[model samples]
Target: MPDGCCSHCSDFGLVCTYVQPQRKRGPKNITIEELSKENASLKAENTSLKVKLLSLSLCSLCSRPLQSLSAQANSSSVFHRSTPESATTPPSPESPEEPPDEQDFTGDDLAERFGSFSIDSLKTKHFGSASTFALANNTLAMKENFLGRPLLIQSRRPLYWDVLPWEKEASNQGSDHVLKFPATDLIAALLDLYFTNVHPTIPILHRPSFERSVAEDLHWRDVEFGALVLSVLAIASRYSHDPRVFLDGEGSLSAGWKFAKQVLTIRQLSEPTIHKVQMYLLLTLYALGTSVPQLSWLFLGVGIRCLQQHGEFRRKPGAHKPAPEEEVWKRAFWSYVVLDRTNCVFLGRPMGLQVEDYDVDFPLEVDDEYWDWGFTQPLGKPSHMSYLVLHVRLCEILGGAMRRLYSSKKAKILMGWDGPEWEQHAVAELDSAMNDYVDSIPPHLRWDPQNLPQGTFFDQSAILHITYNHILIVIHRPYIQKNERPKGPVAFHLCTGGTRHHSHREYVVL
Candidate 1:
């Protein structure tokens, strides 16, 4: 029996038998050679068990069952397990190696690559919402703080000198005719000069005398001058660090606004001519509204009065041939509408007009001969002046509605407005208007060089005839707000030269 037990113990090994004592125990003292042999055999058995457990652990499909094996191996003193499957899997293949030499990631590359990255990836990882991403990344990068500013949908053709009728003449005349005291340049120069002389931070352009000369004699009737003023005001409002330039206290802007009001009051402006002036006035008021709310209110009041007075005049008996005063008043009314509409919606105020009330009568009729000029021909004798006024008023109302929707108390404090909803609504309305305007202007009108004026409009009738179509285009384009993004050199040219010029005059806000 002892001989049989001793043989069984030898086969099983002393360590295994010691753990299960009823099976049998090994010899208490043994030769060193025998002990070393036993240790070697135990180590070899432990290593084999460890390898099997590791293989099971690495197989995700079998990992849960492998836990039991791991416990068994641990009991047998085998803890070192191999993860050969995981190690050999090779990091999920490393995204299929990009071409080593390809580098330039242009917009097209970003569109293609990021476009495929999955919106879920963007929302969960990169950007939050589409609107938030667009606002922070694209709009902020373009330096547009105004929420109402339009985004360029696609790359556009550059504004070239050849696009304008006067470009050839201006180029041939060199700097003398092109740059010399043109009414538009003059007003821009004056504003630059005024800002430079008064404000320490603002830089003065090189030709101070030339600029002053242009401003002093600037033709208020010139449509290009109007465009120039709008552009300058838009930029100045956006970039100017000094709020005092436009604010009431001691700045030249207050005086400038007063002066503009005087000019409008003194001059008996024709309809077409006043359209240009009104456009500038509206844009200037918008810029001023950013810094001075009260001043803007004052301007708003003036605009309302102008509209009311004009409405009364139109109602007066037998005013058949639209008097020049009537035209000026009509222009002022529309100017007010545009300015108020923009401010009311953007600044979170109640809308002042209704959509139904937009229809009003005008003395002038649409010339079917100029239908090719790119403006929407009214179905009837649709009052061009009245249409503009009503359009602006409706925009204001929509802006107010939007402001009510997204507005919060915290946002109001930050923006110095009643709510943010109005701004959002206004932005949507403006964007819509821009689209409508772009659509309204026919493709043929864009290429019509003869449609532009020769010089200044000395005769009111000629000016009215020449500018009637273009005024509609200007109102629709709102170029300053529309073409704002810097899209290379070409965008710069269109942005600077796209609109007709107007005289430097104070715009009354009411």
Candidate 2:
């Protein structure tokens, strides 16, 4: 009945039609009512997602007080959830809320409770957008520049002794006290001490000129006051075993204290003076050796600075001199050589003797004969005899002091030898040479100690003799057996002469 024609009707050759009732027409487009329902459902889902994100952002320990947004905000929660429309939108005043208490979380309280909010974190939070973080850090660093200030501040305790009272007083006192003394007078005094006390054996041709200048300058001081000041400061800062004395205490201004202070004050007067002051300070530090332990670092710093500055100065165009200034340069040249040699021995460096390092150069034509032989002569030479006697006495004193201060083995090693046996042999050789030289010298010349020639010729000749003796001994060292033939020709020659003098008598053993 529902089809267009039934099979029975088609067999009877009659057409039949059947039509089903037409279905009601569906809506052509989505209805506003249905869309409104869908939109409400979507809003509910979005709200649920936003609430989940807010909960995660509040942090796992949200029940506890929060210190930072970054520490709590979960990145995954934030990225997945759509931001609430009202999230970035400012709150209206109509929506009332309790005002946050300013004193609720002090820095200490936050640090104690949160434990993660460091000064750096707080700084980042406060200065997050600022580009001057580096400048601020540098300023903070400067405030902590004192030796142990940072450690003291961090630990909340005194790390070292307080500044001495006398030092504080000295600091307060104006340079007026120092300015009272003429700079020229101070310079003269230093020069006088240097000439009289140090390397006196070395001739100073400029002495007369220096003396005349000092006399003429009545107001002009001889020493570089600035240099003297620097020297004193360097010594006090580093070399004094008891710096508290000079620092601000009762021990201040003791003889040694005054001398050190005076020297330093004079040294600080100018840049040119600094070099001299530094040089002297370094020398004194080396001379003092480990006697002043605190000064070791100071000495190292000064020594390095001096070397660097001097090297740079030498590189300057006109710092180097020609043969014309030989006589004038000789004093400085020899002093530099002595200083370099002494430095090598004291500092255990491989530095050698040279004039260029001292900012001077000797003429090539000046015969080595004119150089002081006091440090170079062998004991048997007349020129070496007096010098050797002085050296032996000094060595004896040094040896005794060393033995008292160090282990016997250490003392021997320090004196440039491996063991006591070597030291003994060296001492004996020096003694024998001196004795031979003294004996060989006519009794009249040997007897007169006060009127000994103070000339450069004698000094230079003595140095040559010793240098030659040293060279010979070094060259023959491997070949010569202990107590066999002395390594040097000077000793052999002297012994041969002694044998000739007493042909019948057997040569006396040392």
Candidate 3:
């Protein structure tokens, strides 16, 4: 502290009084009002002496000790010093050359600053939060600032383990790929690649809704929204041109593992919503890319159950038109079904969601922009979402084939059938259904490999052919091997056309 600066002033900036008051008792016969006037005059006279405190600014005192400030200003003009010499006395400690905001301070002035700005709030919890991840990292889950205010923590965002390019050089090696443990700013690159490459295939997230949430900056406070954002970034990283994506050991497959792991770290119990379902599906896609189909299956199963719990699966009878928010859920539910049947056929596992259990309608053919409550015949006019609506319808046929050809013991008992005869009968029925579906596909999106679509409809056309062929292979899969057959010749004729394509190689590898 300065030699005579007020020791009681706060540690930052505060004006300290150096004036010593000189007062004496009044004589008898002096009225009480006259004594008050003389005392007030003396107080103003003492304030006339000019004094300046070193490095003191007015801004810090603006809010605190407001009484001292107002008193000096109000009394200065009305009550003046009695002597003529006091007229030339410049100013007191309360006044400075510049206001607090206008004054500028340098490093030298900051070196000896002091004030008390303690915030021992009655509401805040003093104890630290329990966190296994933070404990492992040797850090507090709830950190405090220099002022002793605890940071607000809302979500369990996964620690980032990605290192920057320059950072890798300083470390001399990135052999372990754990040079850093926090996320960097790669959101723009990842989002661009994801929406272009990944979203067209999955089409689970509604673009308009996602964009609006991002614009409103809701992800920082909303747990489910933040989780979905992380999941998307992870999926998009697989297609990013940025070299950092390839730092993980698994090549392009594990490129987004850091973000995927972050999503995994988050744990909270809340009502099921469309955002949670979309996040799960995105995580499932990332897991599938990273050669962890078991993790993919886990995420996929949870997503389907969440969709069911959200009540989008059961259609309301004579229902009123849905709000835009509600329409997104309706669309997300169909997306879950498509993914559900896809995993069911590829993994050769029974379905987690059943067909007959729910009677939900397919999503509109209208794009997200035009999809609104009370909109007329949503599926009547075709738009950007036409591809997804068609994909959902195609997956329904695939789900039916799973139930019929690949029957369960309970199903077999209920619909009694023998070996070869049942196989032949099932193939004929499914073949007819598939043929009808194939004929129903829009002419522009028809699955003809030789006459491929060129521009906007190109991806849509390409995926339909791949899905159609894959489902055909699954329909005749059981009868392909003669060894598995009991006694008779199996159906080799049905497999002739579907397995001839080269595009479905990706699906088979997956």
lDDT of 1 by residue, 1-510 (tens): 354345667677643333433656676787999989999999999988865653331211111110111111111111123333423322113122233212222222222322322211121122212333333343232322232343223322234211344544443331121211223543455466444432111111112322443455442333234333433343343334444334466554343342233223332222122223333444345446345554555545544543432332222222133233333344454445555555564455654543334333332222322223422445654322333433443444344444433457676667665533554454456446554644553232222334532221112213222233323232333233434343234323433333332111111100
Q: After superposition, how far is residue 277 of candidate 2 from its true place, in Å?
A: 5.8
Model 3 lDDT per residue over 383-438, tens place: 65667877887888889888877878678668775466776777788888888888
Query: What's the CA error at residue 226 for candidate 1, in Å?
Result: 19
Against the correct fold, how does model 1 do in TM-score? 0.26
Q: What stretches of model 2 exceed 4 Å from their correct place?
A: 1-205, 216-223, 226-258, 264-270, 273-334, 352-360, 363-456, 463-510
Which candidate ranks first by lDDT, i.e. highest?
A: 3
Q: Higher lDDT: candidate 1 or 2?
A: 2
For lDDT, candidate 2 versus 3, the one ahead is: 3
- After superposition on all C-alphas, the RMSD of every candidate to the true structure, in Å, is 33.3, 30.9, 30.2
Ranking by TM-score: 3, 2, 1
The 10-residue segment of model 3 with minimum total lDDT is: 66-75
In model 3, state the lDDT of residue 479.
75
